[model samples]
Target: MSLKSTHFHSGLTTHLIRRGSLTMSYPRDPNPTKETFGVGARWDVPAEKVHEVWVGNEGCEYVIGE
Candidate 1:
């Protein structure tokens, strides 16, 4: 199966499910760092956090849902 991937910006609240390994970085913070997520992992990004996502070479797939 082909892997799917997407890029996300800040100012939105949503749920993310990881289909592959990926990294999330908080650029707006004083100390920016990269957080990695594995497959089948659930992540919640609130409107307050200013961040972006980086999909790995293997590709990261996710679904947005309530």
Candidate 2:
């Protein structure tokens, strides 16, 4: 499926599975940082932090779970 953006709440751990290459972006002090994940990659967001994820590549898909 195609997804544009996902918002993760603070104090909740979120699990992500990538079907293709994608990027997760978050705000920082002076600039925002981005992390890319490849196909079949799994990423876990720490419960203490809030994050926003954005799909960076065309045809990329992401599955998110809490």
Candidate 3:
């Protein structure tokens, strides 16, 4: 049997490294709706409220009140 290797985009790798200290609990969602707090949201905010305001978003790097 052959082992399959996984690959990540350079940008994604860079992001991971930059945010290495952060604990990424969420999965890599290709389509993170506002309901899930896609990104640029306050960490304390509930995922539901986040989506209510920010819909169709992506890349959650710098969180509020960190």
Q: Give the number of the best model, judged by TM-score.
A: 1
TM-score of 1: 0.66
**Model 2 scores what on Cα lDDT?**
0.63
Q: Worst lDDT window (10 residues) for model 2?
A: 1-10
lDDT of 1: 0.66
TM per candidate comes to 0.66, 0.57, 0.16
Model 3, range 5-62, lDDT digits (tens) per residue?
2233222221211121223222245664323333333344333221122112222344
Question: Relative to the true structure, how large is the alpha-carbon lDDT of every model?
Answer: 0.66, 0.63, 0.28
After superposing candidate 3, which stretches have Cα over 4 Å from the reference? Answer: 1-35, 43-59, 64-66
Model 1, 2-58: lDDT tens digits are: 333334445665546567766777777788887787777777776566667777777
Worst lDDT 10-window in candidate 1: 1-10
- Report RMSD (Å) for each prediction in the order shown: 4.8, 3.5, 14.0
Candidate 2 RMSD to the correct structure? 3.5
Arrange candidates by lDDT, descending.
Answer: 1, 2, 3
For every model shown, the clashing-pair count is 0, 0, 2
